[model samples]
Target: MVRQTLTKHPWWKIGVIYQIYPRSFQDSDADGVGDLAGIEARLDYLANFGIDAIWLSPIYPSPMADFGYDVADYCDIDPMFGDLDAFDRLLDGVHSRGLKLLLDFVPNHSSDQHPWFIESRSSRESPKRDWYIWRDPLPGGGPPNNWISDFGGSSWQWDAATGQYYLHAFLKEQPDLNWRNPDLREAMMAVLRFWFDRGVDGFRIDVLWHIVKDVAFRNNPINPMWTPNVTERDRLIQRYSTDQPEAHEITAEFRALADSYGDRVLVGEICLPNDRLACWYGTEDHPQVHLPFNFQLMETAWDAVTLRKTISDYEASLPSFGWPNWVIGSHDAPRIAAKIGEAQARIAAMLLLTLRGTPTLYQGDEIGIGEVQIPPNRVRDPQDLRQPDLGIGRDRSRTPIPWNSSAQAGFSTVEPWLPLNEDWRERNVAAQDQDDNSILSLYRSLLALRRSHNALSIGDLTLVDAADDVLAYRRQRANEILLIALNLSDEPRPLLLPENTCIAKVLCSTKPIRPISSTLDPNEGLVLELKEKS
Candidate 1:
């Protein structure tokens, strides 16, 4: 039996995405913050990174309460990140360089300081009061329900000034919008149109699953496996609070808006189980999110059996003709190197880039950058500040990319907002960019190979084997075929090449030496041209 997979429809469907956190990417002014001009200054550097698109984290007008994730003005850029003019130039640079730009759209919520929220909370009689989800206090004067915030407290914040409570799945300072409101939907759609009109490519919609809370506003059921060690938000299953039925309709609306302007893309951030996650793809004829940001690699264990099982299951679970994407690292999670150790990080990289779907790489992971331990006094993440004991902060992974071996790692002139450790200085880009065996070089090689190979870019994936601490797969496009063998362990593992399959040539390897054989060295991987025996 042959299983037909979804063919590529757009460049984004087949290309790689690079994510940059503006505040930490590069500081052109030496003001301890990265800005649009800084990003423009480094356009050539990023343009050469072999990525098809750049997904910039929120740069909108903000109060910095939750960094840029708490967007205040959707239509303008923040002063710290440069104004709208700077943004226009950056967009132009991205387009002029023949690269795409994906803005981080924070539509799930807006900063409470925004004018709409300000008016919404002014009084019960405010015309814009219903623009945000507001519920009166219980008869006894507590929260309206048990909804919890992602930042470690109650999701419903009591607003004494308004004599009611407002819902916020994240921080109290960022209230959830009333997505059910027709006016609010039109306003958000208009914001999207505003950016698309300015030549922006698309958006990486943040927390797409969190939109459209349950209309009834019921309390979330308690998780049967809740433990004292986990954060409070995880205590509940979040059935009614998130991933509600209305979300799909909202997703379709978003899809319609993006479709109106042909050639635009929409990559949503969704973290869900395979079954629930597959629904985001919409119908076979009508697609919702172009790429529903796959993060299974980042969330799953790095072992061979685990990776093979999840990858196969996810692939099989996709809707007919549904495209898949993968991400091994992100700003909110620990660096892949830190989670899986340095040796396995290389294997993870090969799997991410060579997989059947699109791959998104974090800024500094290309150089094998590990998590930076934030000192207690230097910690600034709201997650860390609110719940220091939970160990879920993001500052460690959000450190600036080390551009050189000099002080500040060439990321800034003065001391950066976050300190760079000795590892950053040693593994800086300037040092590894010239070394053929360095992680950066390996990344470049893999990306180049994938880009040039038709089998790798738009091909069908078939699982070959998952055993002996090695996971193997085959990617085929027409007559072209390539075998990807990954050693998840440090000790040597005999690669189980598919029956009648032989290695014609070695495409690339993670280890220093490339062997045109079946046996894989410790923590090594190879993409080889496969030829059948005569």
Candidate 2:
């Protein structure tokens, strides 16, 4: 059997992070929206669920444009969610359960209603005018450049009073901050200190690569491979708009500030290719982020060969000092069960927990909740409304988590802000908690196994040859070796063990009954202790 041993790795390096979309987790009041107290009430459930840390999406003061991404006040809590006292109580509860708390930091933009943005737009000579990007309109009475907003339309919005246009990478109400401004940078850095002082373990920096843009405000080159099916924002290469070199300087500064607060971690949300993403890690002497949030798994095709290459390529791209991270589902992406089948999602979970990095699990995914369709009248996402053709609305994935079969799926006393899945009654945590064969049970088993096996965490990973439909890898630490084999296809596949190696024991599996032979059931995954043939 795989043996457990102690390691000196930080919690962020070896721990499993559970992402909580606060608005949809639970509701203490009957306001149809979740609150901090609701989250505190569920602390026992999360503790027992076996996560090392909890990362909450933004709960700061906002106008609700883009949910809480557009922060109005960086230090204060939104009245809708709770007051400062409620947040303090929640933090205490999380610490009491020995779970780290990570808050989402949105430094790229602030709501138009923010005081800084309000003053910036008030006059050309306002002290904070340069806090946001503003430029004179083109001589031909058009936007200064051809940059497009991620939501849709022009990235530049005209201000009739100032006879200028301000850049907004997303909705017009969410104005991009000028990270180039020294004063603005320092001010945003203070926001980090404020949270660090509150004992927050770390932050998940949103859109870390979009913090700086090309100084010239030049038009992005048109994409040669643009297709009608893709979003309009992808029509251009975005070379001049995002992933700029100067952004690394800002990330480095963030790392410096976070380092001052001992044991704190910085996780950046950078959506770039593996090579480009690796740059965010900086060098061993000048590290930027603890983790750059690898998202290749979320975008790659769910097949053995493709996934195997994706993992190997990512591993090859990382710097020696950079620790890896994996994310399969998030508030912004479709649910794993919706993207792949429920059976494959189980296999996906095995892959996530067993991989050689910190894994982040989205709320409700443990219970196998899929995407919930939002009706036309109830649509809430601005992205879906602005770019209806792209169908990139996130409302389906951000639906309320189903806790039970009661009204509103036990998420709220009243109707939740978003709809719940139709199968919530049968696919909820309460229902699955009682079923041994449920996906929730499999997740619990996987998490428990991960906690007990040193080979699964902080171990070296080597890809093992396997059948065409089966993806296999061996995770080893010293004398301990555990092989993970995943059947990516819908049909049973033969497990091809490495030469001179035999399965000594089944440590854990996606199915209720562990297989004893060299055959994998449809969409089954197994973690087996390997031994050399005597």
Candidate 3:
């Protein structure tokens, strides 16, 4: 693991991050695909949109096998997304508005089309032969072991020339890099430095936990608790193939590299539970990711009691130096509006922004974007394309953002890569920007409140027993004491405050800011100034 650098600047803890799925974010070229120029044109929109940072998903040159997750070249931009000149201009525009830009880094693997992998696969005596994971087939002429791919197949792909198989955790076109190779590790580190030199603020590392694997090449055991109804990839436990101890050392190296750039952050995408997830923070002396992406909110049940337990447990379990983060929706999951209905999504906005730590808002959740149905032929996600009956496609959540009611929803002149929602005209940025009661306005108000109030941004949290259907927490930093009460049920729930305590005033609410009340209307939440009795 890497050593600590005395003190750290807490931009991640202090600000909100917005994830932009590049292809669906904005298409300026009108070529049915989004590009850096598109994002550059919209810098003012994001700045006024109230986010502190914009994390762009994989803009590296790729063949788009996994929608840019498969990196063919790390040091340059894809022609489809414009050239390096476009990226530099985008960076300049972002900093001009006092906002940060974080690029997505995929350290675990590279596209098969990458020169390093191509050379490594050419012959056994190639200079870069050891740069990738390649092994001889089993004695019985099967895969090296029983390991499975995330995209529903064997992780090994046979190479015709080398007479060996290479490991690919996802698509066969994406080869896993050999992190154990010192030369390979240095090369990847150089890629990080290359981007840092270009003035990018941070990175959101993709699939961080699966980067390393077992040395013995042992078969993973069958999952005892897995059900047939679950994803096919979960049929076997990933204990042996994933979450190796060496992964921490690799991440620490990344942390050290990022710290060298001064104030740049490393956000890891790890989907493990809280206890196991804590390891990514490293021990007290050495640290790993600045913020291991917290996906608990996306996975938790939509209710007061459930979310309360989740937040409390996560907060308590954090390592001493580790800071927490929250994600409501993302390119991978269903949007919040569709998950629990639009009304509850407003309460969700209050819950996300008012929480103690930093929050990440998905691109479209602010305007209450729901799921868009994709027909069989139009589906782009490989998961659904592979298993059409499972109904687990991710394309619905990743539809193009509806800016206006114009043709292509103002995203493109031509048809978008993914279809826009049918309600794009009714539920759009142009429509919501004017409506004070719109979800977009609620998000802005929450962000403004968060920025204006020190207590909400950096404060101690104390959970109160408001009611079974209501969630209440007090945040206090010195004299700035406030209470947040959320009604999670469809019916009105009375706010049951503790003894000798009363709300001074309601600062904000799902409906409207009003006088302190004993009960919250159905699906409403209140941020209140609190007063304690003598």
Candidate 4:
């Protein structure tokens, strides 16, 4: 059956999103960091790349404790990145190029250095004492509960002056805000309006699921499946500390606020199982986020059988009004090429773009950049420093983008905040743009195909029966039908066509040359037009 496209579909529903880690994208000034002006300079590159919107990581005033995630001032731009004028210019450039811009909205926490937090911790009777989550210690003067921070150790920090323990889901330097406080909620909502008034398109809300916590401050249950392989935070199930039912009310409020500014989109960063994740969409009568970011592709096993089931399960778990979005990599995760080999990364790219939903492409993935090896002295991530044994540092994937085969990969005039990929000299954008068979060229082709075909961008997906190593799916929209078959194994696999279906044309392939037969080469993927026998 043909899936009907919404008559008034927003740009976000039909458009592709490209996520840019601001510190790694480009540097306009000689400084070692990327700034808003640097992003403005790269507008032409992104505009021509066929992305509908750009989702930038946090660039607000911060102390760099958590690399901008610990926001000091939500309503202002960071001096290290740029001033408000620079941000305005960047937004102007993005909108002029017909591209939307999304800022990283971090409402769950703020830097301990923030004025509000400073006052909240000044004394027990401070005016803003209830602005942040603070509670008296247990009878023995320990933490209030057994909850653990995402970084490590306890989720609470002792405030000697206030004689209380404050909650911090991340580092101790970043304190969680009290969403239960009506004043705090109003203040955060004003931050959103501030951006909206300045012409900002929308936001990607960070840790949307952690906005509201359990009121009782109960201890988390012990995780039976915890092991030495994972980080210490997984020792408990986090049942009470996160994904509270009240969080939905905040999302609904956010949705209403965004609706007032017609055409604005809200993308939530939520990490949960498919069933629970679907709940973020709210009911048909009261929609929440436009898209709840899905990271299943990054977390799932890379085999065909596993991926096929993952995709099907996610599709089945979505609410009737919930729109699906996919992510293969992010600043917090390893690159696709690093997780899988370069060859399989190409196949994964094809799978990502062909799926029946919005796709968010991480910067530098188009050139097949792998994870850079970060030295101990250069590590900037607190997650890695606190838990070195777990190897959870994200610096490897947060390296600078290689624009040309020059010193520092043309990302900055000085040394970059993070190291560039080792092969930056050869695998840069300039070099790849000149090679017809390069990964960049394949991405360009795939994006162009997706833009031209309705069956790819907004079509109904059907899983086609295939061997264990081959993931085959059909996308159909009225008379248009496209078959995507990906060989996930190291050996060649024959295409298993469905009953009475025939290949009409080979539109694109991951290999340098298009496949001429039904057999797909190792780690290859193909997009083919299909027809039914008379």
Q: What ranking emerges by lDDT with the best candidate at the front? A: 2, 4, 3, 1
lDDT tens digits, residues 1-534, model 3? 111221333667778899999898889887998889999988988888788899999988898888899999999999989999999999999999988999999988999999999899989999898899999999989799988898888989998878999999989989999998999999999999999999999999999999889989899999888876767789898887789999999999999989889889899999898998988999767889998999999999888889899989999889987888898999989888989989999999999999988898999999998868888788998877776777778999999999999999999999999899889999989999999999999998888887777788777889988877899998998888889999999898888776787777677888866665677889998888878877
Q: Give lDDT tens digits, candidate 4, residues 419-455.
A: 8899999989899989988999898888888778889
CA lDDT of each prediction against the hidden true structure: 0.87, 0.92, 0.89, 0.91
Off by over 4 Å in 2: 1-7
| Candidate number that wins on lDDT, 1 or 3 | 3
Error of 2 at 63 (Å): 0.7
TM-score of 2: 0.98
The TM-score values for the models, in the order shown, are 0.97, 0.98, 0.97, 0.98
* Model 1 Cα lDDT, one tens digit per residue, 1-534: 111333545878777899998988899988988999999998998878678899999999999999988888999999998998999899889989888999999988999999999999988999888899999888987999887788888888888787888999999999999989999989999999999998888999999999888888898998989997888898998899889888888998889889888888999998889999889999967678988888888888778888899899999999987888999888899999888877788888899999998899998888888768889988989988998898888998888878998878888999888877558767888899889998888888888887778788888999886458999999999888899999888888887778887878888999786545547788988998989989
Clashing pairs in 4: none
Best by lDDT: 2
Compute the lDDT of residue 291 as modeled in candidate 4.
92
Q: Name the lDDT value of residue 85 in candidate 1.
A: 90
Q: Listing every candidate in turn, what is its Cα RMSD in Å to the true structure after a full C-alpha superposition?
A: 2.9, 1.4, 3.4, 2.1
Q: How many backbone clashes does candidate 2 have?
A: 0
